[model samples]
Target: MKWHHVQDNWPAFFEAILDRWPDADEAELEEIDGDQRAFIAYVIELTGQEPEEARADIREWLSGELPSDVVMDPRHDNHSIALSKKYVPEGEDEYDDDSRFGDEE
Candidate 1:
């Protein structure tokens, strides 16, 4: 995957940019829209990184596969959650201690 990969699916991959730059505001990121020059400039503005380093980092960031954890859509999110539903009973809060799972019949 590259910049074009993200450009083609902005909403799906937008979280990816956030993963890299958690300090970045989502609103500001939306304005970037995956343009290479714009992203590098934004990163530079955000992190104060030199332009050369920012360019390299952005390239590296965009080169990898979209993580499995990325929820591309609500339907895809269901598929990922389906595999975990057995261990985590429906409607159980995620923060709750799941240690009781082993005690179940």
Candidate 2:
């Protein structure tokens, strides 16, 4: 997906991806989701955070750079969860490369 799509759908998309793997980062995600981490990075960009901000946050928290309470707060504005259910319809094509979405290239 394009970065514009990620900007529009960041909240929901990120939430879904993170829910599947709360500790995921670009490299780890690249193995699991292929090119789709571009979308995840795009979501972080839309937040005005760096590509690795989320991953760094996870790492720092794990290393005690930040308090556990700060890290574990559910109130953190992960917009992905809220937007996820609305952007793509049930059974709709999400993968730009999906044969179901027609030939992408």
Candidate 3:
């Protein structure tokens, strides 16, 4: 499947990928230009796991069995964040006045 498809179907796994390669320097992690083998290799290095183990782990995580200790970075999980914001009740401000959201005043 395409990378975006994978990201949509397996968001946690995508989040893990983005956690490893932040968008600050790499703009588009979704548009990774290569074969699955290369991507698998990258995943192995990123997660510090054996090839077979990493693949199996990723599969499990994608299937909604994410480990309790696997914390997803908000900076990378934009889809989930956006969804939360979209569904948040009116008058309930979840975010602080951070520069990341632009001018506070």
Name the best candidate (by lDDT): 1
Candidate order, TM-score descending: 1, 3, 2
Q: How much lDDT does each candidate structure score?
A: 0.74, 0.45, 0.53
* Residue pairs in candidate 2 whose N, alpha carbon or C atoms collide under 3 angstroms: 11-79, 11-80, 12-80, 12-84
Candidate 2 TM-score, C-alpha based: 0.21
Better of 2 and 3 by lDDT: 3
* Candidate 1 lDDT, 1-105, residue by residue in tens: 656657766767667777898888888778877676787789999999999988888878867776664436877666656656677767875445546777444
The window of 10 residues in a row where model 1 has the poorest summed lDDT is 96-105
Off by over 4 Å in 1: 67-105
Give the 10-residue window scoring lowest on summed lDDT in candidate 3.
23-32
Which of 1 and 3 is the better model by lDDT? 1
Predicted candidate 2 versus true structure: per-residue lDDT over 38-80, tens digit per residue: 5446446544567678556433433422222222335432443
Regions more than 4 Å wrong, model 2: 19-21, 24-105
The per-residue C-alpha lDDT of model 3 at residue 81 equals 59
Model 3 residue 17 CA deviation (Å) reads: 3.5
